[model samples]
Target: MGSTADNVTKGSCICGALRYEYTGDPAMTALCHCLSCRKIGAGSTTFTLAIPSPNFHFTSPSSSSSSSPGSTHKNFTVTHESGIRLKTHFCGECGTFVAKEGAGENEFPGLMIVNAGTVDGEGVFEKLAPPQAELWVKHRVGWEGERHGLMQCAGFPDGL
Candidate 1:
């Protein structure tokens, strides 16, 4: 159903201040319309890939970056309206959100919810598996038509 761990996928933030590399196939992919995601992305919906924590790691800053040791990114934690806690990591320099880490109580604990748009390389976005679901469909804006045929849930799927 997906690529193997050997197929490395690399990405970074808008300014390349935060870089990352992940191995193996993503656990799942989805288009989220939740308020938390919308605010973070400043868009109607956010495309995300859920990768196991062990498979995802932040790469070293490029030589041109002024980022010093241990200053790769910044973290912002928020408690979702649904009662789940999330800590979002953003590029320290450009403020581009890189990924999100959920508290243990989250539906996908230990999974890194990566911002799919940050992924680099030609046709890379198309290479990852297609989104399997759409979360928080109730919050989807009217202008954005439905993603027909995809599993649409009002909130995070139970036990996902």
Candidate 2:
């Protein structure tokens, strides 16, 4: 398991079309039961690692701007699409969702927030703590209602 002190973790979608570079230390890493995340990830919960927006970068070698043979860092840019003011760059070929920007820009101020499950590594999940709180508890599945020790909230957290 990588420590919180580690810098520059890399990840990509299953098809390799979407790639990302995360530089900042993740702030909150948790499993979310919100309906939106569950539908998109196709899982019971969505694992997320919230990072600063400026710390995330795209790193597909084919997109490098310089035609020269030796430039190391590829030219990359954050993109916006799908009616979302926040920049959401995904794979052009495979349509794999990559990293997102502008989340909590005005509210939290400086954080990109990528899905930790998308991160590439072994035992990444082990390093994270079990979710401290559950949002949108009104929508939680019936079976989950009896789970022990889960903090439940009827809606998004007051400050969230």
User: lDDT of all the models against the reference?
Assistant: 0.82, 0.56
For residues 74-99, write the lDDT of model 1, one tens digit per residue: 77788887988888878887889988
Q: Which clashing pairs does model 2 show?
A: 52-112, 53-112
TM-scores, in order shown? Answer: 0.86, 0.63
Clashes of 2: 2
Which ranges of candidate 1 are over 4 A from the true structure? 1-5, 61-70, 104-107
Question: Weakest 10 consecutive residues, lDDT, candidate 1?
Answer: 61-70
Candidate with top lDDT is 1
